[model samples]
Target: MRTLLDLVLPLECAGCGVPGEQWCTGCSRALYVPPVVVRPRVDPGVPCWALGTYSGPRRSGIIALKERGRRSVARPFGRALAEAVGHLRVAGEIDPPELGSLVLVCAPTRARAARARGGDPVLRCARIAAEQLAPETVLVPELLRMSTGVRDSVGLSAGQRQSNVAGRVEVVGVRRSRSDNGGARTGSCTVLLVDDVVTTGATLAESARVLKDFGVPLAGALVVAHA
Candidate 1:
């Protein structure tokens, strides 16, 4: 059953602007490849698990969601991200548990970016991943904004990316604590940083630095795509 507007108006594909398909068949085919689990220690201080390379339809999809205001598309993109990093293990993987413990901490986007995009796309994707992995994992939003800057990581080298965001993240707030209302304090918990894409991993590495300083156990990073 189609609505009057749906029938009267045309809908172009998010990826290729093709009519009828939400994502054009050609673009959908470009969204992914067999998932590649890359242990990228590119950020030195922080470890990361990246999925597919940034190119073709995958690149188009990410751009559509980020710059083109396709918030709804993040669901499928997030699903792809989760699948890419789901069974990951190792320092540069899905934040390997020290004694079998897993916690997910989504990276915080800048206020300007959030405002420009209408909402936080990375957080949206991370929330989807959390919902899909609920009950089996402990996912929480424990990271906070420590700086106000933006970096374009499209084609920069690893070292350039590292310098771009150095000393950019800081940890604030203690969750599960009674200090807010004066109740029993549970202290801080371990965290695994989550994001939508990783070019040089500057953001994730900075997050790890903040968590480590705050006494929270630092796990690796998780992402949907790598460029």
Candidate 2:
């Protein structure tokens, strides 16, 4: 019945005007066919990778996914990010364990933002990608908190960016009790931070700093796009 309804009440492609598919193949191909790798100095401690440049169709697709309620579009977007990270792996940029023991940690959104969106968008995307890349990767939601009254991260200069995120984000809900399975002594594990988009590396850098302080081995960062 639902399938029939979907066929009848056509949904235009979020990427293109093509009917049926949420995002047409052509547009999806254009989304992240060739992901970009950026190495700005601000992203210290943890290596950061953004899938696509924030321009042209990629920018439009991301805006639609974030602001226009095209939440279903996250699947393809996550795949693109995973692919980008995989590309880095092949290029010897990021090194996952031989057994591929890695955790996917998402940067937390403000309480109000989560309430407005009904859920954390980056977490949602991370889960989808983790599922698709399952067995090889594990999803860890061990980052974030309500606002620390930090200054708004927008329009800040590079130096100001460093100061703004300093000591603002904290490590809140990580379990330290050792399990039967021996991992890190603090129960802190290797983690790769995930986010939807990054303009300035301020937010990502801040999150990485907090995770490093928590004694979690900083692996890398994954995001859908860079601005």
Candidate 3:
């Protein structure tokens, strides 16, 4: 069915711009490489992993999904993310509590930006990745939100980015824990932050801080690419 639509509309691959396929095999292979540990300017106080650098196919696919409205490319990206998660689990980098699931918490986007883009692409990719890991994994898409007045982080310095999100990322719908132990018990679920790209890592840092304030401890963070 997609091939037929491609024939009629002549769609291009979001990664390589090759005609017919939404995401070509070569580009898919590029994202399938081993996930690597990355250090951003602002630490999120947890391990951070990225599938690839923000370049070539990875960069192109992200731009297409977020700016060009080419959502079809999300599947391959999500598959790559799932593969990274599986590898981390096998490698002992991500250890869920016994009898608990690995929970993916998508990095929040502005409601206005999400509306303009039809939806939140990061959340969409996370959802797809969670589906691939279902029964053992879950997705919490609304755990965080960007407060109003937060400016876009593009072209901002690391410090500026940090300032922009400082105290501006809010935890949503999560009740404050009454325990003095300082960590919320989320059904024994191990939480992992999910995002499409990480630049200065300010957003992730702020997100983790806010979630912590709400007593949700993050195990780590995962991204499609690191700039």
Q: What is the C-alpha lDDT of each candidate?
A: 0.62, 0.67, 0.84
Better of 2 and 3 by TM-score: 3
Worst 10 residues of 2 by lDDT: 1-10
Deviating ranges (above 4 Å) for candidate 3: 1-9, 96-99, 177-184
lDDT of 1 by residue, 132-165 (tens): 6655565656565636765755577777767766
Instruction: Summarize candidate 2's per-residue lDDT along 18-110 as a digit string, tens digits.
Output: 776777787777655545666755765667777667765567666666666567777777777666656766787666546355578887566
Q: In model 3, how many backbone clashes occur?
A: 0
Clashing pairs in 2: none
lDDT of 3 by residue, 48-152 (tens): 999989999999999988997677777898888888888888788987436456778988887789889878888888888887776654755578889898888
Which one is best on lDDT? 3
Q: Per TM-score, what order, best first?
A: 3, 2, 1
Instruction: Show model 2 residue runs off by greater than 4 Å.
Output: 1-10, 32-34, 155-161, 176-190
* Descending-lDDT candidate ranking: 3, 2, 1
lDDT of 1: 0.62
